[model samples]
Target: MAIVARGQADRGPPRDRCGDPDLDDARDCRRDRRAVVLPRGVARRRQAVDHRRRVAGRRGADAARRAGDGEPAQGAHPDGRAVRRRERHLLHRDGGQPGHAADHRDRRHPRRDPRRAGHGHPGPARALVGRCRHRGPRGASRMTADDLVWILPLIPAVAALAMLAARGRATLVWLDLLASLGVLTLALVIAGEVPSRPIAAGPLRADSLAIPFLLLIGFLAVATSIYSNGWVRHEVAHGGMKASSLRYYHALVQAFIATMLVTVLADNLGILWTAMEGTTITSAVLVGFHGDRRGLEAAWKYIIVTTIGISFGLFGTILIYAAAAHAHGAISDAMSWSEINTIASRLDPGIVRIGFIFVMVGYGTKAGLAPMHMWLPDAHSQAPTPVSALLSGAS
Candidate 1:
């Protein structure tokens, strides 16, 4: 794009001034003026070389355009290593581009669940996930966040069963506290591992949205367990609660926590609904554990209202499932949140809209939003202090 002009004013336009030393001097160029007009200060021979290169560039550009964008023309580099490097860069930019993907394949085995990836194959992020796994002791693979997903719901569940089989109040209390501590520990560990790849176990997954809620539940469980021990003892001493109620109370508390944990971790829509129902059941009994008229009334109201609302959620779940089945022919995991989301654009909009409305209302009622929160006030009022905290903070 450089332009050079002759000193004479009569010169029509600027001429190229290529500094090729092999070219004839200005006097020789003047002598050959009859063969071809050579402008002053220009190398006549280099102009021929430049013209030839222009044609080659146009052809090379045509071939390289057949490759990927942002890449140099093919054969632009002399060395084989440089050519390979250019090809690798182009491949990364192309995202494998159908037939061209083999070169970019990861050497490591795939770790991600294909259902979550919208297909039965690793995605561009496969390499990133592999790198995140890093190295473990003696070349053993480190456990990912997904590996611990099943343990979260199990800790409180097992402790609840242990409490039910145990005799003493102190033993049940100890089990309850220990279970809460265990859940908190695991939540912390899993939380640290969560990054670009989400944690997933069959029917269960904890993505970014669920991690904070899970952490809150775990932390609150430990705090409430400590508070419940003294509160339960005081209630019994004051004759406000029966001594026998302590064991049942601790057992129900753990069950309630287990249900909530499951609810938070569930990736399948059906599993989520089931966990919500589990919460309603376990927490309802705990709400009325006092065995009084007011507590009984609150428990009934809470269960009834929540159940009716959840029925809407069930209908919505069914509608969405049917829509997904119709579109994908049931081979896909339509009930799974991840799988459904991957193909969300393909579902019928009208059905999806209506189903999501039902889902919102149902889950919203569970969340205690206005107009659906009629039972919340009474239930929180009648439940024990620790149970009230759970309903307010974790439930």
Candidate 2:
């Protein structure tokens, strides 16, 4: 037998540790055919290495085909020491590079019994192997808290639809109460998911600022629904309001509540304004539901005053959108709270100041602040008890 020097090709077929050439090839083929069972931490590394090798091999094969060579140059010396070394490096990254994960199989003792390998810990071993799988950073595709929390606004909007479909006074009353209860329950569930700061999804957001306010709305919505049942009965019994009018009132109140819910959940200032305007339209009818001259006058005042304020808010929103486009280079980015907050310091100071002034004048009127408070008392006093509660508590 001629002994070959290191790095030289052995003058024979590749043999296993037992000196059988067929055994090594057969064992390797079996290992390749069988699924690789490895510890979770090492499995990921092996998968990555395997993927890279497959890609590289595909590229090499394509190049060989393009060059009119069916076989690669490396195929000439498959059993050479250099070829085996390269193959070993390609197949595994276990040569102790600091960045590469070390395989745990090389340890002197098994961490757990080999007999119970595939079957999980039978006697309180705590399943250490499976825990490693989930220990990595969360993937980008994972759903965010905002994705799950948006159902809060939808609950009230659905409630509004049910109110519009109610057949009679009794049905309207029960539907209103049930919808309010549903809104309250959903609000509580969403509030629990919110953290101290705002969590956002597209144009909607929930945070410490919105959650407390939403909780108040939820309570008030349910409370007013319960109270309105008796109030509607009193109005109808005394011939104060027609049955047809009460049904419209029920529908309008729910739409109003849905608008308020959307307003609080809005991440974009534009959405907030739209939802705010929605409240005005829906509640104006409720404000003047009594059909008296005084109620009608109050509702007109509420509409006229709020409309002016809303116009100012609209101008402000447009200016801000322009500024946002100028600052961030996109019209849509201008409407995003995340984008605006990110580049706020870089925005034009003059534009920002004017925009904020309009915003204040517009939203302040809706909030019943200072001079805008004129329509507040008249609208609140003339409106029904439930409508008044909603305007006072939510709007």
* TM-score top scorer: 1
Cα error of candidate 2 at position 51, Å: 56
Residue 11 displacement (Å), model 1? 99
Q: Count the backbone clashes (under 3 Å) in each candidate.
A: 0, 0
Q: What TM-score does prediction 2 earn? A: 0.62
TM-score of each: 0.63, 0.62
The lowest-lDDT stretch of 10 consecutive residues in candidate 2 is 99-108
lDDT tens digits by residue: candidate 1, 165-251 = 898878988999999999999998888877667888888888888889989999889999999889988999998799876778898
Model 2 regions lying over 4 Å from their true place: 1-148, 196-198
Q: What is the C-alpha lDDT profile of model 2 across 173-253, one tens digit per residue? A: 888888788878877877777765566776888777888888898899899989998988898999999887666787788
Model 1 clash count equals 0
lDDT of each: 0.78, 0.74
Clashes of 2: 0
